[model samples]
Target: MIRVALVGNAGIGSQDHQNSMYRPAFERHPRFELVDTAEEAEVLSIAVPLAERGTAVADAIRAGKHVLADKPLAATLAEATEIERLAAAHGVVVVPAHHQRFGAALRSAIAAVRAGRVGLPWNVQCDFVVAGGDPAPTGELVNFGLYPVDVLRALLGLEVHRVHATGTPDLVTLLLDHEHGVTSTVVCGRVPALRDVPPGGLAVHRYRISGSHGVLAVDARKPALQVRTTDTFGPVWTGPGTVDVLLDVLAAGIAAGRAALGPHDAVQAQRVIEAAQRSMAVGQPVAIGQPVETGE
Candidate 1:
């Protein structure tokens, strides 16, 4: 059996090893075991706060354990870089738990895009909106808005070239330019009231990728995807539960002695996020994919 230790005790951590997210799958699988601490496992899944990720991962690596760290790897690029360097020095794999990358609907959409079914993606629009929740400890942008941005980046297989961001406590808007000439606008917010049918429910994340030939839209809240063509719209494609898929991937990567999200890739994503924050602060466009001064 592949021994796994869950590092946090709150929120996601509470459900980490219990299979609360995917009880059936965990119950059926005989190769995985969830333990309470890193001392008892060969793999560690760190689902703690962003500020704590680097330390948690470093500890696991120092113990000769592989890690599956939750996304936004660290609160800042410097911390992420340090984590990457440490993991490399120890020869341990550190995968980011970017669950959206494993979503079936997203996979199907990317396949269609790659197959020329969409005819060259030019513009992408995405939104992740939710109802009110308690104030996030990490603030709104990092707490909820990061998901759509991360998913968009992963689906496009393009690095962010620049970003223009603006936001209030309840809403955040980002216009991102990608390396492949693809431009995207992402909106994330928590609106006060829910519409009748609900414009998009709380916890709802959606995206529309438009190309020369057609458009594909994914409604992640319903956990379904739809492809629209000039002639007709296709059927909805359902996806697996997000948490379960993430855990399974983590387990598999650990068993194989590798990380699903490489250190460099995770750091790159963190840089983009930091750039977005800078854009929000300066009220101007920020260029990405280039070196910026980061405090070590």
Candidate 2:
């Protein structure tokens, strides 16, 4: 069996570990075994606090285990870089848990875009808003906000060249310049009024891609997709149930002897996030893929 260990007890891991460990989906999988500690596993999943992710992932790598970390990679670019370097040196795979990457709704939307159903996507709009909760932690972006940013990059197959951002404790807006001249605007926030939607209720993370042909909208909240044409607009059906697809991807990567997110890709994403932070700090657009002067 492919031994796997979960490193965090929060959010999905708390529920997933309990449910999947007991359910046939994971328990009966002929190629897997979920262990309680990294010490007994060939692969580790780090789903802890943002600050601890890098250290935990690095430790697992040092111990010769493949690692799958939840998104945003690490709290800062530096830590992410270190983890990447160490993982590479040790020849361990480090895959970020970008579960949305494997979503059928999202995959379908991207496929439609690529098939020219939406033409050449020029502008993109995404909203990841949810009700209730305190402002995100100081100096940190919201958990789900990163979803759109990363998704835009993946769908477009481009890197963010520039970023302009503004926000308050509870809300954030980001304007991104993509490689192909595509512009993306992402608005994310947690409003107290939305709290009534239920815990994990209607956490609306959706995107609208506008191209020369039409518009394609995908909503993760209801797990649906909408395509707008010149004469008609309608919803497209997708698979049922919320699958932890990333975990399966992680498992497959480990079994195949590969890292989910290579060092370079992880670093690049972190750099984009860091640029957004800098843009917010200086109240100006920040150019990505460039060196910034540091006092230290």
Candidate 3:
């Protein structure tokens, strides 16, 4: 059995709630055991806020444990890269828990894209809003950027070249230009929860992908997902977005000595978010140069 330790939950402001959404997953899995501390575990599953995740991850890696950290590894790309380097030097597999990427259904879609069913996806559009009517729109970028960025980047498998964004907090749209002439247009927002819907119901999520031969689309209302509302304590994860899948992936990574998903893609997602924020601020397109390390 793989012994695991979980750190952080929902957000930075919230105290460490040991009854995390991840708890049930680890304890229920036959191959896993939930350890009380990082010292007793072979793997650390970290879901701390973006600012502090870097330190938590680095500490775990230094202790020679594999880690599955949450998205937006650190404040800046440089710090995120350094953490990746630290993990490499320690010879431990460190991956980001881009949870949605590992869902069985989405996995099939990814497989189809890889198999050339779509003949190189060149155009993509996504619209996702999971909240009530009123929310402070200013915080939407931080609240909404990571998941779609990760998903779009996975679909394209290329670095973004430029980003242009427009709209107020209630709605924000972004045009992302990727390498090799591929592009994506995205609209995202998250407000407080709608009391009308139950726990499993999310607002709206739609995706349209166009390739040379065909197009793939997914449109759903109230799909089974776990989302946090402004009023809720935190996101209570279940279904495909649960922490169970992340731990399963981590266990397999440890056995293979390599992670199926690495931190690089998540770092790329952060770069896209950074560029989009700049785009929104300047009222014009922002260039996202390829990531390079300056060994300073």
Candidate 1 residues lying further than 4 Å off, grouped into runs, are: 11-30, 193-203, 223-238, 289-296
In candidate 3, the residue pairs with backbone N, CA or C atoms under 3 Å apart (3 or more residues apart, or in different chains) clash, namely: none
Q: Estimate each model's TM-score.
A: 0.81, 0.80, 0.84
Every candidate's lDDT: 0.69, 0.68, 0.72
Ranking by lDDT: 3, 1, 2
- Candidate 2, residues 1-296: lDDT per residue as tens digits? 77877777443222333243223334555567788877898877666776677777778888998876666677777777787778768877787755555567777777788788888999989887766543445432536556667678767777889998898646788899998799999887776644235433335678899999899888755454666778655445455433345556666767666744354566676777778888988999999866333221
The runs of at least 3 residues in candidate 2 whose Cα sits more than 4 Å from the true structure, single-residue gaps closed, are 10-31, 133-135, 139-142, 193-196, 224-243, 259-265, 291-296
Candidate 3 per-residue lDDT over residues 173-269, each given as its tens digit: 8899988899999888764666755432346666788999999876533234556667653334344543567667777788988877777766787
Residue 207 lDDT (model 3): 71
What is the overall TM-score of model 3 with all chains considered together?
Answer: 0.84
- Winner on lDDT between 1 and 3 is 3
Ranking of models by TM-score: 3, 1, 2
Clashing pairs in model 1, backbone N/Cα/C closer than 3 A: 130-202
Residue 123 in candidate 3, Cα distance off native in Å: 0.5
Higher-scoring candidate on lDDT, 1 or 2: 1
